[model samples]
Target: MSPKQRILELREQIRYHNYRYYVLDDPEISDAEFDRLMQELKALEAEHPELITPDSPTQTVGSSILEPPFTPVPHPTRMYSLGNAFSQQDIAEFEASIARFLGREGPFAYVLEYKIDGLSVNLVYEEGVLVRGLTRGDGVVGEDVTPNLLAIPDFPRRLPEAWDLEVRGEVYLPLQTFLELNARLEEEGEVPFKNPRNAAAGSLRQKDPKISARRGLRGLFYGVGRPETLGVRTQQALLERLAELGFAVEPHHRLVSGVEGVEAGYRAMLEQRRALPFEADGITVKLNELSLWDELGYTAKTPRFAIAYKFPAEERPTRVRQVVFQVGRTGRVTPVAELEPILLEGSTVSRVTLHNESYVQELGLRVGDTVLVHKAGGVIPEVLRVLTEAPRGQTPVVWPSRCPECASELVLSGKIHLCPNPLCPAKAFEAIRHYASRRAMDIQGLGEKLIEQLLASGKVRDAADLYQLKKEDLVPLERMGEKSAQNLLNQIEASKNRGLERLLFALGIPQVGESTARALARRFGHLDRILEASVEELDAVPDIAEATASAIHQALSRPEMRRFIERLRAAGMRFEAREKQKSQALEGLTFVLTGELSLPREEVARWLEAHGARVASSVSRKTHYVVAGAGAGSKLAKAQELGIPVLDEQGLRALLREKVGQEP
Candidate 1:
């Protein structure tokens, strides 16, 4: 393909996969394959620098490098990234910038979190349920990865109350899990993974969500997309609120004085780095006080109040002892280089991740070859470069042809080999697990251990069998008490109202993601209609392509699947689509809200945003309008200064009615 054509093709493929991975929780290509495509795109972008565009996948954090599987679902608000700080002066300048913007240094505390080396995920919850999980795809538009997120054990599916809000966090694999996974893969004759960060990212982007589930991925939430809604006045309180609402918050955070506190905390963290369970790239310094976040607002892509104090990427010489393939939770086999023990930074390093088959091939890695090893994020080991000279005569590293565990022939999807066996133990547990996941049927008490116990007892055959579960059946299991059993049943009963789209997604049909499910549910209105619909009718549904429609139709047509649906239907599950979304009449319009409004500002903001308005914290010249309330402050004054259109609560309500004609 020509450079331009190749870039376009790469972007198209990346986007499609992003949709599949993020929106659908059903990726088509493996991570290695996706990475290779990305590397090629990056190489081309570098060689032809003029070809680069702001919207290019190369420019976005669509999970580490290769941008979202490729869906472009807009976030309620743009999720901003952090600017970097290399030295103490950079950190000082960060505080100085905040003070300069605020015109004072009053109450400027700092909150520091180890800049986790992982993919950034945004979560949206409404009416107590987590509706969507998205990647930070260019801030405004992110790919939905909710189902994959639901696979994360600690990720809250529902909040304590019916709270409508967004939470942001870093999703990563713990170091011990990474080591164990790599060890198991190596023992099974599969290659080991080199870095935990990419492994975590790749795990989340699997076509089979079971990959994410079985991989034991974890999340540490630290951000509230709009803290204004929660009445949180500081960064530390926001985290505490997250914990109270049932989220796993990183405990390594501290709220202290500006540069000195940050430097001290960073130094302490560095001292205890090896003891931590996960990888942290740097120290994140954020203004502890949240109220001032608006006053000292954002630049184009980053906030002025926050900066990442990055650890230097240093390398050391190491010899490759052996190369091994590590099959990940999603059946993605990545290459890991076993190295002769060498000191890197301060610790002894023995293994380094080669990333993928393409990466290893690119390096032309061989046994006993010298290479430069560095810690990616100063935690995960990565082979920076191959130092060996000419070794053209050496045999190339052997790639696996079959799954290490199941011994099933691997299907080469795109540029990566994947084990397509549905019953592979590596992926089988996910079927029922996903069916009971918070995003799906939402069977609350049905955790992994319980599912394993149930499966071992042979009382449950599939997700459909979950409906057949009895209290007596559970009481006999290991730890399931009468109360636990009753609670589980109640949860299962409640899951019936999760609606058709969630059920369709939980069914694990090939190429059928949440959006497709919603499309199908909306078009058909009922499960019976969808089951009865021909491929032609299915194809005619918006966004359901000919191939995807065919796949859906065929999957639904299967006798076993029919039986599964029948059982679920018999279980009193509701199969219905919500009303089509209201028109985005306020799309492209930016609004800055100010003062204490009579109506809850959170609700008001949510309403405006739902109909497609951008609610910014700080007023800028680009702001289209300013919604001012009672006792308006400096923001109101600024709005007046800039001559931006100002509206009261009633005025805003009238504007919404005029624009959308209803409470959309």
Candidate 2:
């Protein structure tokens, strides 16, 4: 076979194996055989980059874009949240309410499934091929998290039959994966996520797909947005259809009639919750019939046909030994109650954040007070209430007036106390760590120990000082070898090209996250311009608000921050936007691609985005251009009907040559 033909065959084989191993939990080939096939495909793709497809396995490693905004994609049908039922009375009332709405009485068919505490996402498939996976933002519109969703091993990139549909599911990290992730976070001196739900939500929304992939995220489809289109009449049938289409459907969803059966299912789920490999805080009870769903209708927020029956809250008494102050990377001081060790949800809890002085004062807490503690949502351990009414001569929880590490005077910023000292050892270390983080500069060898050593030895005081460190400075540190020191230095030097968005985020600007940084970088196209931008100008950028703009303006205006920027500038780091700098070439234009292309559609997308053009997924009247290729389908016909301009591969390339050229 020719190289192209062989490459196609290898891709098919690898995809089939991926299905077997990840989705089916069975493997036809050994790991070595799989590795060999993957290696061969990678080698071929490396040699012939133009042959790479968007759905290719290699693409799952992640896109190289630093902090690109997830394109907002509207859901075909609204993905509504479920109403909560805390007690048996509430469940009965919900049943009665549904019955009353139907203008009938007695039993109603229902399906009960474990309510997996995780992020809800909608997956859109066109002709059996996965196209978009989105977060349920505002029920109407959602951030397109296709790349991160694709990173999930069990998420089917393609279905069994050639069908177009949308399915909703919970994307969660398994209990084991959550524990491991939390352990890693603790080891890195970073705060652990409160629960698996938070971890899963955080991981799914990660800017980098590779990082999401490493988190071992999993999914379980529960229902379809449009069941009639899929010829499914009941929730149970929808689950079966999802399974038939090679989706990882939620297991053990039982069909029952009336509130009693639903209650039984909920109880069973509660009993089995701890033994399960994932967190289940409740059982979601839904009316099974698709026909009656419309009649049941919905509240403004939640669906009327379904109710989440939550398990009873778990709380136990524990005494506060003392209230201690902890300093975070942001220099915000938090009061934590060092409790007498007590067990809660399979973990020992000795410390819980008091949140602020107001929280402590509200609780009327003292050192000797007994308080109810539990894992809030079976994830974060938190103090519930004080049992004792009287103090009994116990000391009141004291608030500190100065920083615990550097003894710098604390200032109240809004509701919280903050240390303004940039050179404070704790804050400096955190700043350097954040700068070298995988999401930032990604200096691989500068782990926490090396950073602490660099700080303690006075080799580095801030992020800019990191670039100034020589091999001699690192070599003297414990466990630093000649080769290791050189590698570390090389990594640090290589970080200079990480681009302006990453740099902005690394600078630790208050209220500016990775997405906000990207917005600023894309707007101003340079770090210097952003620093000088007026609040009104900053607020003019899409998604940037007045408050965020004010924060950005105020932060850059600080003398310490100004000095830091100068140091960074003197270090020869990139101060200009290096990626996706907007050009007027395709200004006010929007393009949509369809069918087989000579180059990957992603490659075309990158080019369009770089030239100030939007690349939409579906064809609409707003779409100015439709890049049609061989075997173009519905999108092509729609574009033609709407009188949108159509361009072939040759035409697109010629246009590129005339416009943006080979800039990227």
TM-score of 1: 0.49
Cα distance off (Å), candidate 1, residue 127: 3.7
lDDT of 2 at 530: 83
508-586 in candidate 2: lDDT tens per residue?
7766766677767766888888878899988876556787787678777777778888888888888777665467577
Candidate 2, poorest ten consecutive residues by summed lDDT:
59-68
lDDT of 1: 0.74
lDDT of 1 by residue, 1-664 (tens): 6899988899888877766544444454444345557768878989999998876766654433244443458899888877667778978877787777778874468898887877788999998788889877657777766768888987888887787888999899998898777654432224455567657877787644656788889999889878987888999999899898889998889888867878888888777766779888677888888877888788655788888887665667777778887665445556678888988878889876666677777776777778777776566667766776634325567888888777866644323455544445565566778677776677888999998898788887577777788899999898878998899888877888888778887776656655567666655767888888999998876556787777667667766567768778898878785533234687678888888977687767766655556666666688898988888875687689889999887888788878888752
Candidate 1 wrong stretches, greater than 4 Å: 1-71, 105-107, 183-194, 318-341, 350-359, 365-370, 376-380, 387-664
TM per prediction: 0.49, 0.56
Name the best candidate (by lDDT).
2
